[model samples]
Target: METKIFAKDQIDEAVALLREGELVAFPTETVYGLGAIATKEESVKNVYKAKGRPSDNPLIVTVSDEKMVERYAKSVPDRAKKLIKHFWPGPLTILLFVKEGSLPTAVTGGLKTVAFRCPDDKLTHDLIAKLGYPIVGPSANTSTKPSPTTAQHVYHDLRGKIAGIIDGGETRVGLESTIVDLSVETPIVLRPGEITPEEISEVLGEEVLINTGKVSDKEIPKAPGMKYRHYAPSAPVVVVDDVNDFAKIDFNDHIGVMALEDELDKIDLPKANKFNLGRNLVDADHNLFSGLRYFDDKKDITQIYVQGFNEGQASLAYMNRLNKAAGGHHF
Candidate 1:
């Protein structure tokens, strides 16, 4: 299970691994992705094996730009086009109806829609264009575990499980992409990431339905980071209803507190460690999982407590990861 870190100049060797129907861990602006040729059934299968991902959980296709988007999808509606004009080369992933014979059934989980995005990262764009195909790029980590934000995180989680590793340094955004489903009349937010529904609505002059935020069977997602346990750490976690409530808890064993920078001074438990995820939602969103990974790695912390953020644009993705990490274990 040895994981090797290849320089950005050596990314072609990683692409060669994908061309050979193997998986490689690489970086995107959002997070590290386990990449495989999206059209190659065997190569896509390797991504699942490498991450131990479930067959039912589908993968997202990463493309170079909007021109490539037309190659795989049957059609991009007007709404989707507007979104593309605004959000491509960023963290937004649009779900389009897959064209016949364009994508393998396994990659879509036998669904009619396929999620695709043009990443903002230079290395990721170069790799996709060089490989000359859309790639199945999922977060580079084991399923239901903390995502790999750094090359070492990938090496630690995916070593021996994949063919190669491309080190592009730490990810810019420590969260996954914002996924919008354009198949419906009103664009539905399937998964929230760095992009917010508010921003989408501002452009379209209408509200986007956020379906992923609800805890219901009908709202179950057809993509990764949905309908499954995710971003969890080894120790048990508790999400506090409010920052003031966090102060009431007694700290006996070494405690780990997950809070905003503003609340850091508010909680005063002795013999404790803290990871301040920034006071602003953007900074918090960008470092949520990496902070979780940091606390999860610390040997002294016995239990982790978290405080919820106010609902807003940047807070959307932050809450998603926190909910998954808390997993209903709120105090």
Candidate 2:
């Protein structure tokens, strides 16, 4: 199949493709998402096939507004409403009870709950509004690969596999949305992103539990990244907790270092072998995946050493993705 690249304004072509049960990738603040109309079972299943994603790993439904969510969600709790007022059209995904038969099993992963988000991108919102229903959006890259923050990243990994890509340029957040499961009595964050649990707690005026335990292989993950390895490159990644640890490693041409600008200056590696992750945690969050992909393009990079931050000080979302990419390997 031919893979097309659409301009940000070219929503008609992408929407038409989706209407024909074809998959098209759309952008959000967090990441570019492979979109399939949520109600179309065949299209939704093809999304899993396209990404080689596990069938049981559910997808998040991308909607245009709260009304779209109300159409499918059994009931939106007051807490969810409060969160929506604060975080909707941003990087927050709310998991809610689904009305039976409202969405395809392929989308819900046969679970009674479904995740929904209204992206901040105007083009994406317009596309969804034009389509007249929600689209199941998982990160556009092939499963287990670094999530695509740019359209070129999507094209590199998924060209010819999906119908087309709506190029909305680079994503802002550079990570997935914070997923809060409101289906249960006590809201638990199934995944962390730009929106922290503390921020969510403050908005809802209640305690939000962060699920840190690994979901077993025998069990289906309630969220996309929970049960699988994700955001990894071809090279092995080592998390460097202390910048001073750079002195301990025997530097070689095959090693690539990703760290803050100042941290890179302290390292002895060649300038070509280092990728700057910028000044602070927010910059690191935005640059993380791009840095991983940068090294992937360098065939000689056998391993990657990335800067790590304390769980308390760093964005949990950034650390969560880095931990997965590194497979918990610390330097």
Candidate 3:
């Protein structure tokens, strides 16, 4: 299959491919998502085949608007309405009880609940609206790899397998949406992203639980990135908790270092060997996957050393992704 790259204005082209049950990658504020018509079992299955994603792991249903979610979900609760009002069209995913037979089993991973999100990107919103249905959108990269923040990154991991990619430029959030499971009695955060738990709690006017425990491999995860080793690259990654620890690393072998600009400057390494994580936490979140991909491209890089941040409301999302990518290997 010849994978074409569509410009941002080419929503019609991308919609046409999706209409034909062809898998197309679309941009979101969070990350690029590999899209398949949510109603079509075959098309959704093809997404798993293309990305080498496990069938047991569920896919997120990406919609154009809040109303689109009402079509597939059984019923929207009052709490969900609060969240949708504040966080819709942004990096927030909500898990609600699915309408029976409304979506394919492939989309829900045979579970009664389905994850839904209305991406903030105009091009993707237009694409979903034009199609008049939801699309099953997981991060547009091979399973367990860093999520694709750019169209070119999607092409690198899933070039010939998919039909085409809608190039909407680099994603703004550079991470997946914050997934909250509303199907339960009390809402729990299944995955952390740009949206913090505190922010969600503020909107809902109640405390939200963050599920920090690991999901065993034998059990199916309610959200993406819960059960799998996600956002990792080919090289071994070690997390450095403190900026001063950079001096402690043995630089004898070929190594790639990723940190904030100030942290990078503190280390004694060549510019060519260092990948900057930008100036602050937001910049670090935006540049995390790109930095991982940057080092993965260099043939000489054997191991990667990434700076870790103190866990807090602001830094939780970044640390979640970094710890997973590093596999908890600390310096």
The residue-by-residue lDDT of candidate 1 on 147-253, one tens digit each, is 88899888878888887888888888889999988888888888888888889998888879987454445443566777778898887778886777876899655
Clashing pairs in 2: none
Task: Return the clash pairs for model 1, or none.
Answer: 1-160
Candidate lDDT scores, in order, read 0.83, 0.92, 0.91
* Candidate 3 colliding pairs: none
Q: What is the TM-score of each candidate against the true structure?
A: 0.93, 0.98, 0.98
Ranking by lDDT: 2, 3, 1
The residue-level lDDT of candidate 3 at 248 comes to: 83
TM-score of candidate 1 relative to the true fold: 0.93
Model 3 CA deviation exceeding 4 Å by range: none
Candidate 3 lDDT trough over 10 residues, lowest sum: 244-253
Q: For candidate 2, lDDT tens digit of each residue in 186-286?
A: 89999998888899999999999998888887887787899999999999999999888988999899999999999899888888899999999889999
The residue-level lDDT of candidate 1 at 303 comes to 87
Kindly provide the TM-score of model 3 when superposed on the true structure, using C-alpha atoms: 0.98
